[model samples]
Target: MPENTPYSLPKDSKAWQQAVDSIASLLPEDISLHDFDALQSLPVFALIVVLPAKVPALDIHHYVQSWVDEQPSWHLVTVAEDAEASFVDVDVATNGSTGTQQPFTPAQVFRYLLVPVTDTLMHPGKKTAAAHIIDDQLTTRLRHDLAKNYANAQATDHPENAALVHDNLVDCHILSIGHMLRTHKLACFDMDSTLIEQEVIVELAKTAGVGAEVEAITEAAMRGEIDFDESFVKRVALLEGISTSVLDEICARLTLSTGAHTTITALKALGYHTVLVSGGFSYFANYIAKQLGIDEVHANHLDIEDGQVTGHIQLPIVNGAKKAAIAQHTAEHLNIEMSQVVCVGDGANDLPMMAIADLGVAYNAKPIVQARADAAVNVTGLEGVLYALGYPALVASKS
Candidate 1:
């Protein structure tokens, strides 16, 4: 190996000592390089994250998996082909002299880790126990919680705070393993504030001279502070007697979410089923779905008379329960399991449907929604959901 090759540490060097210390910090005080083999034989499973080389500096084959019957592990160097090299390896000298044996070499990309879900990691204390240091590498043990609680706990509560604790290397979460990407046949989306940028009712409220009032109620419902049913009715009543001309104008001006086009088109091209299940009005839902090439739509129907707003919705409001039922029925109708579905949304109304799907993603969601979701995509657009469905980062980036 070249003298200057990065991440290549000479045997018995200071860097090597620091590296060993880092790994040991994630484990018990007595564990060391000798314990690696024994630990690999433990009868437990963990959620492993191999961040693919999404960024140039992070050019490692990244992936995540949770299969039972396998031992818990933090692999620094697993076998990956051109795009499969996920972790860093420590190629140490085996001859007990200067650079004699070939251990795995690890890049700065997380070599591998074995962290237990300590209370401190999940619910960080007000201040660090130790003083801040420039060369620190933050680590959280993804131990054998086997259950998805570890991922969910880290995600729901001030996950961003954890990122700051790690100096921002932590991007998102992969809590539970969903159905394999290949099995995904259907993708369901919420319309207001999710599939589309603005809430249909809130936009309609603007034209009805009650924008502030409706917007307040909409925000409250989305945050789970107010019941979605009551909030929906109150907002609609405020729109009474509004002209239909406003509906058309608002629908015409409606915009798709930033990455919605890329996500929907990619799904269709790949032959995946796509649908819009919204608590928003059918008129707007259908309009957005048609434009996005969505296959179906189920939404609230607004009653109108003489081209003036009646503000009365027809039977079977698409509340949270209805949203989930629609998702289930769609899956059964397509002869697929709930595990084959991918649900994405931004509000409390979206949670039920998201819960039942194989992979439920909260996209730029309210704090309450993000906390409970299996995964949350706070930094990106709808295309981020594709990544949650196990799509290649390259595939999502193209969108």
Candidate 2:
């Protein structure tokens, strides 16, 4: 190993050839090299080596360290051990401009940075410092720019305190940088209180002159204090004799929650299969889905006769468990993996489906839902989901 060698591999130099030859000689015959790569930044140089199972981790570390020490520059070497694989990281310290470090390719892992978009540009050096603290190999693209109030960066290396580091980002709602932010092919949402501002049943109750009684039942059911099916039946019974025209009127008056349009529009443009699985009535859900361009809508059907509500609901009410089933079925029908699905909702009835999805987002949801969801967005609109999905503001805009 030559002393004072630059951090980068000199493709055309004798020193590079010698270093390669030395590494090959040091490896045990039983341990075969799976991959080899070199990464270079201004003040840091890294050589990544991957090996298959059954290699002695400590021995490789000691030998690699000794080899690195023979080099001219001060090099820091580390090793990562896995059940069937191992990675060696070598960082070289040098004198250079300590400005923004250009993104570098990592060896065998990916590093993710979860930060609030508003605070990302405000603290330009925070990311660099974070990368160093985590001992990441290189910073990749800002996965999500300052779009919908969140941003993320992808890099190399695994950080043990990933959650803690993510929470440290100022005003960051979620830092699902690593495995949590997988490519989602399907997205399922709850209609009432999630995609829309007011509950459709409550709106119908007011027209039926049972608003107060039905509202209490609705609230209790949403709070998980009552059985969804029973409460739903009770609420619908109060609307008996009400004109069917109420459904059309209520649907016309429905108000979409903030960022609802933006979120669904962006998801559609990104090729995501959007689904609205509601415990509410299809009378309203179908209309909402059409308006939002949702690909699918599944909800309860209200029975009517003589142009009036019969106080009867069709079979197979869409409850919590059913919602989950719908999500699973949708994923399977589309041939998407379960890990590639995102479910969002705001009520207790939404819990089951939320639990089954790869990433469950609580959108201004109930306390219980927020507590259990994988990610929660209480302060922002539905658009915040775009950020959670790792879509940058630039990409969101194009979508």
- TM-score per candidate, chains pooled: 0.63, 0.58
lDDT of 1 by residue, 1-399 (tens): 322122311111122223334444454444433443333322111122323232223222322223211323333322121242232222211222112211211112222222332212221121111101101211122222212332344456757533332212223443321122125789999988787778889888888889999999999999899888899889888989998888778887777775676567667755689989999899888888876779999998888999899888677889999999999999999999886788999999999999888678788798788766766664355666655554433221111
Candidate 1 ranges with C-alpha deviation above 4 Å = 1-170, 395-399
Q: Model 2: which residue pairs collide?
A: 3-72, 4-72, 111-155, 144-392, 145-392
lDDT of 2 at 154: 18
- lDDT of every model, 2 decimals: 0.58, 0.57
Angstrom error of the Cα, residue 325, model 1: value is: 0.3
Q: Candidate 1: TM-score?
A: 0.63
State residue 250's C-alpha deviation in candidate 2, in Å: 1.1
Choose the strongest candidate by TM-score: 1
